[model samples]
Target: MVFLDEPTTGLDPDARQEFWKLVSSLKQQGCSVLLTTHYMDEAQRLCDRLLLLLQGQVIDQGTPEELIERTVGDEVVEIAGIDELQLQGLTRQADTWYRPFGDGYVVALPTQRSLLWEQLGSLQPQRLTRRRANLEDVFLHLTGKVLQ
Candidate 1:
């Protein structure tokens, strides 16, 4: 068994890739590897399961995809340049999850994009992007959004 704590923390991207390859090789050789990393991409790439920790407590545990789907849902929409009033209005809508991010908000939903479009699209945001949910989304959802 091997335990690696932020093993690739300071490595360049290319070096990180190489390190991950080595970790993959270890998995192939049937070695148990316990890895801890703040980099969600690394965890998603290499781990078959993940343990989500916050404030020194285990908040959730599952396959990365399972975790993401369970917590943040299927899709996330990012809208830039929204005001606090708009945020409050959006929050009051039925069945939605949202969080404020830099100069914008990240909204998640399992369905009802058209409904959201009807409500928020009229605002004509500076930038609006829709993407599939990811581990970071799950982390932020399960844990508090406030920076520690």
Candidate 2:
């Protein structure tokens, strides 16, 4: 077994790639790896299973995809320059969940909702985009929008 905690934190990209290759080789040789990191990309890439911690407590644990799907729903819509209060009534009517993000808010839209599109269009946010959810979404969903 091998233990690494933020092992690639200060490595340049090339060195990080090299480190990952070395770890992959070790795994192929039947070595088990235990690692701790704040880098979501690293966790998603290297871990078969992951535990998410907030405030020194385990918040969720699962394969990355499972965590994302279970916590963040299917789709994310990011809209900037919109007030949370302004969207509250619409969001309630539309079947979407909204949380403040950097300079704006991200609304988690369920894939099954066809009416949400029309509701969003009516609001005409300064910017809006649809995307699939990932680990960051899961983190924000489970831990909330607050930085602390």
Candidate 3:
């Protein structure tokens, strides 16, 4: 077994890529790796499983999809507009999982993008964006700490 601490730290993409390839090779050779990293993307890309921790305590553990389903649901909507009234109006129709995002708000949904789109359309938000709630969001929501 081998333990690596931020092995990819300060490395360029090419270096990180090569490093992961080496790690994978080690795994295939029956070596076990225990890696700790702050980059959620790196963890998601390389780890077969993850344990989420906070303040020296293990809070959660699971595979990526399992973590995804646990921290965030199906999808999230990001709305940017000129006024808080517009955000409020949209959020009212956006259901319970809505949250503020700078000059905007994000709403998490279990399913049906069309419903969210329709609600947003009715509000005529200046800029609307839609995407899945990825590891970044999961980390922030669960930890209340954004990773830059």
Candidate 4:
């Protein structure tokens, strides 16, 4: 049995890819694999079944598609800058939250940041953060960003 609790937290894409292949092989051999992850892409591509845990309790559970449809059925946008100065003014009208990134910000939005995008419509950002259902979105929703 192999238990993975966020095994790819800091692993690069190549490493995560290799780790996934190994886990997939174990599942092929009929090994009972139990795991916990905030990464939706990993669970979607790897697990036969997934259980989402929060504060030591099981909330709603389902496949990535199911969970995403139920919670976040909106387009996502990601914007990165030296700081969230533009993010602060542009995001005041929509639902948004700041997820800390080293020396900057990684924002996740359940709604589109049209206002913000228009403001920076010309100034291309260093990075763009979308509401795509990855590990971060799953954990954000689970942790209750909007619910907060």
Best model number under TM-score:
1
Worst 10 residues of 4 by lDDT: 104-113
lDDT score for residue 71 of model 4: 58
Cα lDDT listed for each candidate:
0.80, 0.81, 0.74, 0.63
Error of 4 at 40 (Å): 5.4
Report the poorest 10 consecutive residues by lDDT, candidate 3.
139-148
What is residue 81's positional error in candidate 3, in angstroms? 3.2
What's model 1's lDDT at 144? 63
In terms of lDDT, model 4 sits at 0.63
Q: Which stretches of candidate 4 lie over 4 Å from their true place?
A: 1-19, 26-32, 37-41, 73-75, 82-86, 96-98, 109-116, 120-126, 129-131, 144-148
Backbone Cα, N, C clashes tallied per candidate: 0, 0, 0, 7
How many clashing residue pairs are found in candidate 4? 7
lDDT of 3 by residue, 32-138 (tens): 98999999988887788999888988878898788888777767777777466655555456543555677776666655444656767667778888788777667
Q: Give the per-residue lDDT of model 1 (tens digit) for 35-141.
A: 99999888988999999998899999999988987887788888887675775567557366678766777877546444775566777888788888888778777
lDDT of 2 by residue, 6-116 (tens): 999999999999998888888899999998988887888888899999999999999998998887778888888665666676677665677887877877776675677
Expressed as tens digits, the lDDT of each residue in 26-118 for candidate 4 is 999999888777676788788765667778787767776676656554444555664455566555555555544455454545454346545
Model 1, stretches more than 4 Å misplaced?
Answer: 112-114, 145-148
